[model samples]
Target: MSEALALFASSWFFVAALLAVLSDAFLPLVPSGTLVIAATLHLSDTHTSPFLLGIGVALASFSGDLLLLKFARRGAAWAQRRLERKPGAASAAAHLLAALETKRARTIVVARFVPGGRTVLDLAVGTTDRPPRRFLRWSAVSSAVWATYIVGLGFLNEHTFDTTWLSFAVSCLAATAISAVIARVVQRQRRLARETEAVEPVTVS
Candidate 1:
């Protein structure tokens, strides 16, 4: 138990967490939330504070979001053109942009929880002239919320289960299930919105 605690407390584990979170910003395939939950579960019983780890994860994720946003802004036209070539991606990007136009705060925060929505929203927003400061404000909020939620899941499991591995596994599975459900809900809502928009003009005419 002492050796396990020591390993969890080591600098390498924290660094790995940061890298996972950062890479996840650009690569949706990365299971960054699971890693964060694992880290939190492992360190939950240790002297090291889970809140501190959450903060680190938040900062790292925010940095990655900022970097991607900047890059997207710089190549907005090129990115848009490429997205246009892919019908599915273009439709998703359009939905993100429309949502951003209507409810920037809600979209930003909700997208962080939705699979593949983060990158699409960032790119969609980048194509616009949205103020950098405004984006930063919402981006920070989203990152903090995501970090807190994932870390909280770990802590919840830690408190519920006697075994560390069991707690970690449960937390990860829960997170995955929640993410999948959220993604499906978001996608369904967007599709309905698109259908409504399409029918509105016809009904009006």
Candidate 2:
């Protein structure tokens, strides 16, 4: 196990983290965070610098997010161009654009932690008139915090467990479990809001 850590610590660990985070943006369900935690767990024993690893993860994450938004922006432009030719399409697009601009920062920050959320929010934001500069600023903060959270989890698990692999497994499982619970809570809240709207009484003029 120590020999394996030595090899990974010397090479591939950073590469794996970067690629994993990059792919996770497009593929939403990819286990990028898990990969990071596993790598951290292995390297912790090897005495690798945590700061450097965190930076790699943060930069990779930010790049992936930027790419997603750019792709979304281009796609939105194409759709708008095509839709411009159709009746009422511009009007519909305008409505969506207005809604998206309203909560650009809040959306980006909140969605950063949720699975598959950043993808949807980034795509939506890209379709709006919000400046990329604004998104980038907020994304920098989100990426840093997220990288810290994920890496810190690995350290926590490492300290708690005797076996390195056990630390990896438990960290991944705990993360998954926590995310699942958060998802359920968000889902329930949305459902209740919809139900409340459905049962609201309408006043006649």
Candidate 3:
């Protein structure tokens, strides 16, 4: 993997980072962190500063996210049509859309770490009345922080970073598990709120 990234870094850093970000936006399990780490490792190995690699990764990631947001806004109707073909999927889809449309600010910020939430958040923000500059600012900052952490991990583990994909895999698993627990907690809270609303009495004229 290290060798592959080293070869890619020579001539394909931009493309690789762009695809990594796009994949990360749609597929949480894709290990985008690993890609950034690998890129930084390769750069460090070649006597190049990791900062350049980090900047490249961050820019590519931010660009990919913005593109996804644009697509989500313009293609939502088509996406809905496709999603409607699956059983029991339309209801959940509708619920997610409603949540995005109604809770753009909070949802976009919090959904940064949640699996499958990145694209949703991007789409939500794109479709809403929020300022594009604000969304871009927040998303870029978050992407930079995320890229830095992963790249820093590679730097710290430079000795065995390439040899032990297991370590990174374990970290990804841990993050996913924690995110799942958080999602469950959030869902429970939403359910409680709905229940409370359901039981509220109607006013008489």
lDDT of each: 0.83, 0.73, 0.62
lDDT of 3 by residue, 35-105 (tens): 66555555645666767666766776687688877766688675455445555345434445466566645
Tell me which of candidates 1 and 3 scores higher on TM-score: 1
Model 1 ranges with Cα > 4 A deviation: 1-5, 44-46, 81-87, 200-205
Error of 2 at 102 (Å): 6.4
Task: Give the lowest summed-lDDT range of ten residues in model 3.
Answer: 88-97
Clashes of each: 0, 0, 0
Most accurate candidate by TM-score? 1
**Which has the better TM-score: candidate 2, or candidate 3?**
2
* lDDT for each residue of candidate 2 in 43-136, tens digit (9 for 90 to 100): 6456777777888888988999899778878898753454466554454334334434676565556566778766655655677767889778
lDDT of 1 by residue, 77-187 (tens): 976875676567788888878777779899889889987778777777778887878878999999999999999999888999999889988998898899889999998
Model 3: residues with Cα > 4 Å off, grouped in runs:
1-18, 26-29, 40-43, 82-106, 129-131, 157-163, 201-205
State every prediction's TM-score relative to the real structure.
0.89, 0.78, 0.66
Off by over 4 Å in 2: 1-5, 8-10, 77-106, 199-201
For each of the candidates, the C-alpha root-mean-square deviation to the true structure, in angstroms, is 2.6, 5.6, 4.7
Please state the error at residue 198 of candidate 2 in Å.
3.3
Worst 10 residues of 2 by lDDT: 91-100
Better of 1 and 2 by lDDT: 1
